[model samples]
Target: MLLLLASLAFVQYVRTSSSDQNPYLMTDYSRLHPVKVERVLQGEAEAQLIGLVKDAKAKGLKLSIAGQRHSQGGHTYYKDAVVVDMTSYNQVLSVDPEAKRIVVQAGATWEDVQKAVNPYGLSVKTMQSLNVFTIGGSISINAHGRDIRNGSLIKSVESFRLLTAGGDIIQVSRTENAELFPLALGGYGLFGIILDVTLILTEDEVYRESTVLMNLEEYSDYFQNEVLPNPDIRLHIARISVAEDSYFKEAFSKNYTVDRSLKLSDHNKLKSNDNWVAPGKLLFNINRSTDWGKNAQWNLQKHFFVEQSDKIVSRNNAMRAASAFMEYSQPGANDLLQEYFIPLPQFDAFVQRLGAIVKEEDMNLLNITIRYVNKDDEAVLSYAKQDMLALVCLFHAPLSKAGQQRMKQGVERIINEVIASEGSYYLPYIAYPTLEQFRNVYPGYEYFFAKKKDYDPDELFMNYFYEQYGG
Candidate 1:
């Protein structure tokens, strides 16, 4: 058996302008203590994967699988572990359109398989912002988009080929290995390495999209009543104001343009240079972060086909953005992110308190991002439950260490408040929460730890996450 190791040392460099210092935010890591892994096992089938697993066991090298390494958590990369780089295994095994299913190698990214099925006039129902994440990686984390109707990407999976810790090849689905199926959805690659997956694809359709800026006072209503109820409304988000008059009235006059109106909504929420607009607004306001008001025009389009090819391109762009994005989750109204996953029944109250938190905190919120997701049963830790999930990312910039500390402290407070109210924080981008906070955030963590131990008993697949959570 040949061993292949693609050294990751070359991509490490200090990029000062970047947002997140963590390597998990990028394909490469520079800050974390540089650890070298002997990358082995290039590509294989169930039998072949089993053989490799057996070989690793014989060599006494605890092994870990590598996909796109897009996860923000450190689960995908290691310092001195034996890694199986699955990228070489990229392949679309089969596409059974008659059954509305597609089989693809675990190493393949969404961009890979989506393009393969383009001619078939099919598309994936849901996807995260980036396309570079592998099918296995996303399934491991149980990632989902802002769309409420479409929950985690794993829900589309009909079945999977799993290479377990015992070096056994097993077929798992809602029935076969049923308990492990949903368990693995957000399992974080602790139980087994996915060899391949069969996903149910959706028919192609067009999307009508738009971005509107509304006042903070109306933020809760807009999200709960309008944004949450509509599935056709693909991506909906709100950016809040942190600074005074940061939303320059003259800037809006200069930048606001409706490029393609019919394709998107005519909704343009702008506060003209009216009394509401103040100086220093751009520096302090949440809306100033995106500065949508600064952009003279917004793209609006309708009847645009959601073809597989088109989605592939969009997903690729999402990856580029993900790679380049400086670490900032969307900002919310009160200078903080009071995100919550209120059951649909409690949405009304959720919004009301959401606004009150911002006000009481004296946080000048600009826009609140409103994301809708279908109730999904993928990951035990996933935020996709019975209600629409809303993430309020509050931003305050020229980010002084003291100010950041204050904001982060406030964020912790808000997170605690939400958890007390039965909400979970989005774990990927979180930077300051403690292990106890993490435990509270995901009550199913005990099960997650058990799965990790069952598969990676030796703990060779280690990272900062394992050390922090003791998982």
Candidate 2:
């Protein structure tokens, strides 16, 4: 055991040593595509941003929006374009406890929102599992999370200001500028730069966490018959085992049930930092390396969550889940995410085929998380066409050209199964799916791109995502 541990440690060290250190070139989380940018400007003031847009147009250069650059695809940047960094533009504008709403700048993260509203006993209605993502990025992607009641992130947004290609700031909402509402929400920053957002908030409550172990076949039924029917259960997420022995067979669900007996104040103090990141990263690297590590990770996760059953936590604290442990900066290899939204009825069949494909391709799948999203067709390129179960998958792959080709082929195969299951995949990840596959899954591509041309005829706002599929 000691020798095995030493060997893994040495391998991790070697991988870490080759980390990317070039400052001139830019890349997103995936680190697969690195390219040079004309310049990166800080988004400090609205006037400055508008001036920047005008300048880019005058120079006949493209503009790309960037937040934390978490989107794995090339959505946040384009080669030789001016990258507008929005992280420094974050600011909490207003919070109304009576109205259950908050207004914030586009660059503000969920963490910023949580800290501002925790005192008022209010929480975000819908967001991604982690609080580190920026509001602009989340809304651009129309993200969803463990909470099942509020639908997708777009449902929580009341209104937002968008800086269009013509240097005009316009208010977009369901009732105002209605035409642009659907087009801009999941438009991948092609429509305009989201300035600030007014979001609907919900009351923060204490809940008791519970875990249930079951087989893969039983999850969909259990969720429909048991979870959805219960009002007290607010947030729920499940996971399927990826270990060799229990691969895609064993599953477990973690449900957060309202616990009125517990005091919200007792648990509402926000966590400032992620704990045990070093050890967690070490163990996760092991999980990425060997089959033995996979089995060990599965067992450890089962024991950890099961042991914490009945633990009390506040909504804000729960949403602020630990993410530091997932960070990987290895040079030649990296972890990437791909999510597929399968209609509830087809969940079983999809998982069965998914397991078969992964095994056949010998893919290095690290994790698979299951979350629910209600039917939402409001966005132009909506992924949740119906009440669906999302499979959030994580995989580790090499960054070499040949390696990427192999990964792309495997990913395309999985997307084929997703299409056959009458499902759609998330667009924020890599563009491994062929353009034809993208059109098959999102039939509204024609209208979406046509609107882009209508709004920004010069194609002022551009990125790799548009360059790839906007044809």
Candidate 3:
């Protein structure tokens, strides 16, 4: 009882101390590169956005698009640029249950879409595991998650309206403005402002959660022989232990299998609030602080998931995974995410090398979640060149310059291993990997930047991502 009270007090202290005071400076979830911006404007009416773009172009000012600003990299804002906050423009434009499709403003979050379509027995086909991110940001990064059957987020996008640097809102998809379809979807906001998106929806399903604990080396075979071939399994995710004892040697797979015998209505209630955030945050902070905490977290997770085995949940409910527990707000330190996509054939080999590097560099890795991404080359900047397993890793990093430099060096070493194993690192995180490494992983980058020039010749759309690698 005393321990619980102490944890709650610490949570309150962290919350009260983490508040931001500078209104003129902008940074992302990483809190690493705070820069002064000309002004931040809330995206409202379409006409206002058009005018903003026109005025920026005329004034020779660059514009950056922002949505929740969860991207660890400076993909959302730049120095002295006008940052358009898109969350306000969020609205579910339309939903066609019969057609299994939905159109929404770019600023609309996955939560908004789920809420709007839940009544009609619909859910998003693919998105990040958490539903807090905006549709624009998800597509901008071309995110993917637990659902192994649907492929990456781009595969589910039907179309979207782009507000170009030239102040024109044009429809882009497989047919209309077809040339821009691939370029803009995963184009990382360099192409233009994504005004609204049309997405393909899937029917909400009832799933029975199941978990299997296995050695890390057994995961590749288990997934191929067991998980992939099983048609009943709709969504899957796995976690590799980061504790001092097991480290990356231990893993457990969580599968949500179709339960046709269960009624969807019984499990379809959406998880609207994180009722246990305070305790969850406290536990996670403990997990972040020490080796003992890490071991405890790993064991607790195994017990928790095993206990919840056979739990029934709706597809929409499962998509709304608990993320509030992972939120961190320390003043000098923050949690950051980096992902590496490895071809299935090399998963074991790559993980071995990754574990070795992390140990040698002494990186403060908190967690590693594995998810499958089907071969997708539809997006020009797509990460999944072949059927791959994505290692979504979270690390607690310090904001100091020396700390950042050390983190960069360690990350670059990991990227080296990734590239050697025919893998690719995700671009939405910090720009830690060298440009050479990025080009080696993403060979199409040259053409991608060229297309950016072709579309926005004035270079009106700007962010640190382009500044770092677009050259």
**lDDT of candidate 1 vs native?**
0.55
TM-score of each: 0.68, 0.96, 0.97
> Tens-digit lDDT track for model 2 on 1-471?
545655665566556856674778998988868899999998999999999989899999999999989898899999999999998889999999999999999999999999999999999999998998999999999999999999999999999999999999999999999988988898889998999999999999999999998998899899999999999999999999999889999999999999998888888888754765656667788789999989998898899887757778899888988887677888788898999999988999999999999888878999999999999979989999999999999999988898888889999999999999999999999999999999999999999999999999998888899999984
Q: Superpose all Cα atoms of candidate 3 onto the true structure and report the RMSD in Å to 1 decimal.
A: 1.5
**Best of the two (1, 2) by TM-score:** 2
lDDT of 1 by residue, 30-105 (tens): 1223356666456656667777777777777666666865444456555555667788787999998877789988
lDDT of candidate model 3 versus the reference: 0.90
TM-score (C-alpha) between model 3 and the true structure = 0.97
- Cα RMSD of predicted structure 1: 11.0
Order by lDDT, highest first: 2, 3, 1
Sort order, TM-score high to low: 3, 2, 1
lDDT for position 8 in model 3: 90
